[model samples]
Target: MKNAKPDLVYFSGFYSEATPFIKQLRAEMKDVKFLAGDGVKNDEFIKGAGADAEGAYLSLPSPVYTGEAYKTFGDLFEKETGIKRDASPFVAEAYDAATVIIRALEKVAQEKDGKLVIDLKKLNEEIRKTELDGASGKIKFDARGENVGGETPVSLFQVKNGAFEQLKQ
Candidate 1:
C-alpha cells in the first residue's frame, strides 16, 4: 500500500502504463523491481536499444511462461516473417484489458443501473478489493490501483503432431 505508508514495495512492468506509479514510488524512495531480459538471441537489438539482457527474451514470452510444448506460435512467426518467436507473453497479456473492464464493472455495480461516475478515490478503493480470475490468470488489485498476478497459474499450450493448441485449465 503506497499511500498507507508501507515499509517496502516493488514494481514490475515493461511499458508506459508502469511509468506514472513508478515515478511516484521513486519519489518516496520505494523499491521498484526493474525486470530486464536476458538469454535473448537478439543481442544486437538489445544493444541497439541500450538495454542489457537479464536472462529474458524481450518482446516475447519465455519458454517457461509459454510452457514450451507448442510450436504453432513459433511456426506462425516463421511463416509470416521468416522468424520464430515465443507467443506466451503476448497471448497471456489478453487479460490486461479484461481486468481493466472487470474492475470498472465492479465499481459501477455500486450504482443501481451499473453506470459509473468518475471518482478517483472510489475507483481506487473499489479496484483494490477486486480479485477476479482472468483468462491469463488471477487479476487481483493492489493498493495502487494496479492489478497484480502474484504467482498465479499461467496458461499452457500443448503441441500435438507439430501443432499448438490452448490447453484447458
Candidate 2:
C-alpha cells in the first residue's frame, strides 16, 4: 500500500474485520478515502474505529427509511437499546422478515399429536405468497423469492463526528 498508493479503498466485509483493517489503512495511507458496503454501517464500526472512522463512505442497498411506523419503531428502539436508529437500519428489515414468518406460520401451522406441526413445503408456499405493508416498505416476493416490493435505491452515507450521515447522491 505504501509503494503503490491507491486513491480509494473499498471493503466488502463486516465491521468486526473492517475496524482493524481500516485502522491499519488509516495509519499507512492517511489521505486515502475508504468505502464499504452496508455491512459496516453500524455504530459498532464507528465505536471501534473511533476518529479513524471519520470521512469513510458506506452504502446500503435499501434507501433510508421514511415510513411513519418506522419512525415510531426507531424511537422505541432507541429508548430501549440506547443505540441510534440510523446506526442499524437492519432492525426493521429483521422485524419484517420475522413478521413474514409468523404470518406464514399462523396460516399453515396445525396441532398434530398434541404438538404444533407445519409442513415445510406449505410454509415455503405461504412465505412466497406474502404481501404486507411492512415497516421498511411493501413486502412482496418475486417468483424466485427475492423481495420485489418497494424501490431499492442505493443509499450512500459518510461517517462524520461519530455518526453516519446520509449523503445526497
Candidate 3:
C-alpha cells in the first residue's frame, strides 16, 4: 500500500473510508479539516459524520453560502502557496440537478389541471436537459449528475496603481 509520510491525511472514499479514522480524528480532538463531500466515495466515512455535520459533506443541495451576498469571497480561501480550483463536474452537476428539479416543479405547477402530476420520465428528461443560472453561473446536466466543477480560484481581485493585484480566487 501507501508508504508515504503524508502531511495531509486525506480520507478519500469517505463512504468506504471507515469510521475508525473518523473516531480517531474526533478522539484526537484536533481540528479535522474535511473535504467529505468533495468526491469522497467511502460510505462509512460519510455516514460517520454527525447529523449536525450535514454541512460538512459536499453533495447535491449543499446549503453552504456566504452570509453577505455579492460580497467578495476572498476571506474564505486557504492562503497557502497552493491554489485549489473547483470547476469539477460534480459541482456543476449538483447545480444542474437543483436547477432541473426546480424547473420540473415549476412546469408541473403550471398545468391547469390543478393537482400536481409529476411525470418521472419527463422529470428525468428535464433533469437531463437542465440549463440553469445558479450561484456559480450556468449549469448543464449530463448523465445522471455525476459531473462536478473546479474551484474558481477566488476572484474579484483589486487594482493597485494602474496594476492588477491578485486576490483570493
Please give each candidate's TM-score.
0.33, 0.91, 0.36
lDDT tens digits, residues 1-169, model 1? 5566654343345433333443454556434333322122232322332322121212223323333223443454558765434322443344445556666766655543676456667666766777754444456767776656556343333322333343533
Model 3 off-target regions past 4 Å? 1-9, 12-96, 109-114, 143-169
User: What is the overall TM-score of model 3 with all chains considered together?
Assistant: 0.36
Off by over 4 Å in 1: 1-88, 109-116, 146-149, 152-169
True-structure RMSD for candidate 3: 12.5
lDDT of 3 by residue, 1-169 (tens): 0244333345555443434554555555344443343344223233454432322323322223332320222222223323222322244335445656887777654454676677777777766666644545445656876333322332322223322233333
Better candidate by lDDT, 2 or 3: 2
Model 2 ranges with Cα > 4 A deviation: none
For candidate 2, lDDT tens digit of each residue in 60-95? 887447888678777887899987776765888887
